[model samples]
Target: MAGAEWESLEQCLEKNLPLADLREVKRILYGKETRELHLPSGAFEAASKGDFELRGYGFEAAEEQQRRPRIVRVGLVQNRTPLPTDTPVVKQVTALHRRIEAITEVAATCGVNIICFQEAWTMPFAFCTRERLPWTEFAESAEDGPTIRFCQELARKHDMVVVSPILERDAEHGDVLWNTAVVISNSGAVLGKTRKNHIPRVGDFNESTYYMEGNLGHPVFQTQFGRIAVNICYGRHHPLNWLMYSINGAEIIFNPSATVGALSESLWPIEARNAAIANHCFTCAINRVGEERFPNEFTSGDGKKAHRDFGYFYGSSYVAAPDGSRTPGLSRNRDGLLVTELDLNLCRQMTGRYKMYARELTEAVKPNYSPNIMKE
Candidate 1:
């Protein structure tokens, strides 16, 4: 099926639903004070013209006697591929650069202190095809790839920290590839990189065919905004993945993902909200929008007919707070930017009293494991 037909089917399915308004659901799940922020008039006009949803929300923090509030605005970008999957790699990269740069410029206007794009935001979602030729060509150096270079320029121009998730081609380590998120500081310095800890083998998500589980453990990058970490895609399903990042001193965690609606839409809002409440840290979950069509057919090993598309991605990208409060997500069908203002002091306030309990519990787990079995 073509992309337009798939989208029309999605619309038909959505119109028959009895689901509540997402904003109302979030307000009830979080508190009444979990309200929206009104952006400048120009921002609204730009979103309307660009055909992308733009929203802003603020998470309030309690008054602290000792420390002042550390406020930072964060932007999350969820977009579709600008070109066809069969496009040349250089042209694909160039088109994506131009597209993301426009969105980043809008984010800068909102005074965003930090920004993040969805998983593999530069290219089409081609892992389903499993072709080693052009798909693997998307993998580039995490340190100085075209994607990172473009992001560096954006970060420097806006003085905003950028979390760029890309397929990485490691030159030093036998040219192995990894699904990685590269952190670029506000000064445009290459801070460090973290690989995806979990690889999904479910359905058409054959990510493990491209790269193995990451070697780098959960390491938090301290930026000018706050101490942040990236939990790429499938890692969001693991509670331990969320816990380890918090244990490593990550105040905010971004899960850059590209999951289809049919497979994991039900669990989308639940996991990140649960993680925020459980870990006592902010969680930002992002997913790309729109349906991507591939040139060849693929199967999910479920006795179903081979298909060319992976269904709709359902881009309801959201930000969950440490106090279980969250902002309403972007639309499921269009490109979007979710701008949220977070007070970093809230993490400390929520987690301060419970830190000892978490530490003790984690320490207690060490003795339960058998020493005879090698750790994974």
Candidate 2:
């Protein structure tokens, strides 16, 4: 009757009650007849007389028939900007506009209902140069900016869900900048945006110089296609971020990122796959391609010192299933869209196989063993 009493039923099932006793509990809970009974003689007599209180039994067969199935198709687009090293920022944005249209056109042709762009896909990752420029002024308000308008139009034109990340200039807050991703619906409506929660300041990755930390908290937007979540760049490194999205009912998550060579590039696919397995959700990791360079820094070295010079963005974009298996990714050295079709049914199938929704006693002990000091 009570929620706590229902929980006791689960505990009793784990203890395996005698058949006669289990049947009596079922009869009391659901007014059903037991198909067969298996019990010791003593327990059988008590159950026959309704003297022994029964536990751990339910009419699961009836509930199974009422459940419905869900299915959806998702896609990811990964590409490189063809901007030469000396191109002006305005021209770079113009070039990106054409590229977005091209990628969206490809996605439409492939019959993808939802599409995503790599992180900061609007402009070349210029923070690596460590130089201030008037062009960085290209950053605009994510909601009404040129980038958002462009994506909104594409989503509407293709009748698809679009996830686009850009350098956002917070118009309301002294025009402070943030690394933000916006989700647009098939109708060209701006759903919401998630700013990069974790900013990296290591080596040549100077994100702090251009953008401040994001203020919009983690959000899972419900769409006609499905419930989806957005995790941008460095946010993927934090496990709790994925957990937040999962608990909020996200069936699909897009990790749009922009990072330099091997080490960080390698972590890109790793994080997305881990999130899918741990949360029983489909994940897509989209990355930028090609080399972007600036003055006072002849950084596009192809050999060993590649990571330091304007970091060559290795474009190995990929998609991971709920079972943690990854699809074929694009070449790390080339620029192209890595397309794949993911069945949302696989998420449900994986959950059933892994029992991710099934409660376990071990979970209660996890807090004691947790390595995060911030949790305490």
Candidate 3:
């Protein structure tokens, strides 16, 4: 904004904004009552008989479809970067390991047919520092990395599909790097993969320094549940990214992201729902929670002093239905699992309140029916 407005905002933050008061307001109004687990950063670890719960918002399918509903219970896991915080290497991976393992076991018992982790989930969002060696060392093989291997076991055990997005180091291909998402099937088979087509240029997200735009275009994978696809983090801003996935016949597209609240909180819930309604597909938006402060300060080239803290990666993960309805978002300041059931036939049948409308429209419009006001 202009100079005066900027000064006013800073003053307001100084005088009126205490972190405690902000949190209290959230607890009363927005933040649902929750019980935090004591394990590292994976407190939102286990899911029992609807412990983390929300009322379903969308409509039910037709009677025929309802009798034999192709309902696939899906889960989205969002968590913070791990212990000995700010330090980006060995400890961080260990923390995520504990977190993912805990959640996977919980989700399987909870009947989640498919589950997805956040983007670059294996490591911190270390690309912000634009440093080498320390962060680059974390990139692992997409084919047989420790991360995918761990997830494969979980998928096989549960008979569920797993989408693990990570920073991939292609050792076989000259150690080149790409932001990739590995899709594993129920039988522990390594299904095909897709990469992040778009990289971010806003603020401290200087990802282009790490890897170029993904070479793998939007590709859909046919799993036992339905046709699925992955739209990695930054691409959520691009509508066509969502379009391409839908165009490729993706019935459910998961957007695994690592964005902060300051950058895109308002836009988060809006864009995904729009994609779902417009494309006639289910959209799952997953983000990492908590802050990962670096040891050193970095400037955003925005005429501001260098700062070590990148704003909080607020996690408000949710699922949107094809009919423009969504469930209540999960916790904003805590790591959590959002599990929701989906009927694949509802996408094809759209048997909600729109049932009669679909039927009427089909009857009203025929192949040769067109505007012929001139009595053609």
Candidate 4:
């Protein structure tokens, strides 16, 4: 048959063409004979077929075959900063810009495509009380915020997707405040924001004091790098939140947090790793480091008298893979950046191997046969 007159694979398969026609179609599509025929007389027949004639078939097959996985480098910046109220707002903004620039430069050198910083990257965790002025001063609109502008410049310069969490000043609605994480694409475009869904109000970490509950739902942003999601500090404790992000098609999720001391610190890795395993997604938890003090009396269990002293902020920034394996994070002792190469293809491989997302197949068990229970 002439190459132009050949039938498509779907047509050939559906029509159940004769062995000879099938061989001809296969040769036309694959550039070689791909079918064998066994005659009813117990005789096998083989025929030499020419090279494939359909360029479109070759293109389709090449596209269907999985491409080699590229290494996606990610960096986590674990740094310490005192409350934004403690320093001049301009000075604080400049300092944050400098720190972000330094980290972006380092990430560029390391070939990191996605860089995530600790929560409240532009300020300190000053929501330890009901007073709204101090925290409100730190909030800025995500579009025109100094921090967002700084991050956009860095992202454009380094060609990296920057995940930055900040106290967003929403000017559209009576200047309402929210704990928001802005995702900036590689080309300096704002993808979307994930608001801190679960606001915590326990002890010294009174997030409700300053910011209201996140109005935005759990959302995953699609970028050139990958499908990414963010869950702020307190939101990390909820499994449903992580699952929601995963269901929304997040391949890698970021958890930027700001909690001090051992109790909250201990729960960090556990929540991140469990989320990764359960949702079949990679999780990066970036926590702040150093000691943050609140000028108020606070007491933990054991009757230890304390005032104006919140325990140390343990900086344990870690990256957990879909297989539940994690890379050790930056030390709690000082400020540093943790950089690692993540193979996102491995997420699909692990999911396939463990059937993590194959609920339809795994849950398709046959019902038990019970003759005694059958109705007469």
Clash tally for model 4: 2
lDDT of each: 0.86, 0.68, 0.77, 0.69
| Residue range 182-245, candidate 4, lDDT tens digits | 9999999888787999988777777776777787887888887778899888888898789888
RMSD (CA, Å), each prediction: 5.0, 19.7, 9.7, 20.9
| Steric clash pairs (candidate 4) | 31-51, 31-52
TM-score between candidate 3 and the true structure: 0.78
lDDT score, candidate 2, position 312: 61
> If the candidates were sorted by their TM-score against the true structure, best first, what order would they fall in?
1, 3, 4, 2
| lDDT at residue 73 of model 3 (Cα atoms) | 74
lDDT of 3 by residue, 172-198 (tens): 789999999999999998997899999
In model 1, the clashing pairs are none
Error of 2 at 114 (Å): 0.9
Q: How many pairs of residues in model 2 come into backbone collision? A: 2
On TM-score, the leading prediction is 1
Q: How many Å off is the CA of 55 in candidate 3?
A: 8.7
Candidates arranged by lDDT, highest first: 1, 3, 4, 2
Clashing pairs in 2: 299-309, 299-310
Q: Which ten residues in a row have the lowest lDDT in candidate 4?
A: 51-60
User: What would the per-residue lDDT of candidate 2 be over residues 43-112, giving only the tens digit for each residue?
Assistant: 3343334321211111112223444435454656556667764677778888889866865665565566
Model 4, C-alpha of 136: deviation from truth (Å): 1.6
Q: Which candidate is the best by lDDT?
A: 1
User: Scored by Cα lDDT, where does model 4 land?
Assistant: 0.69
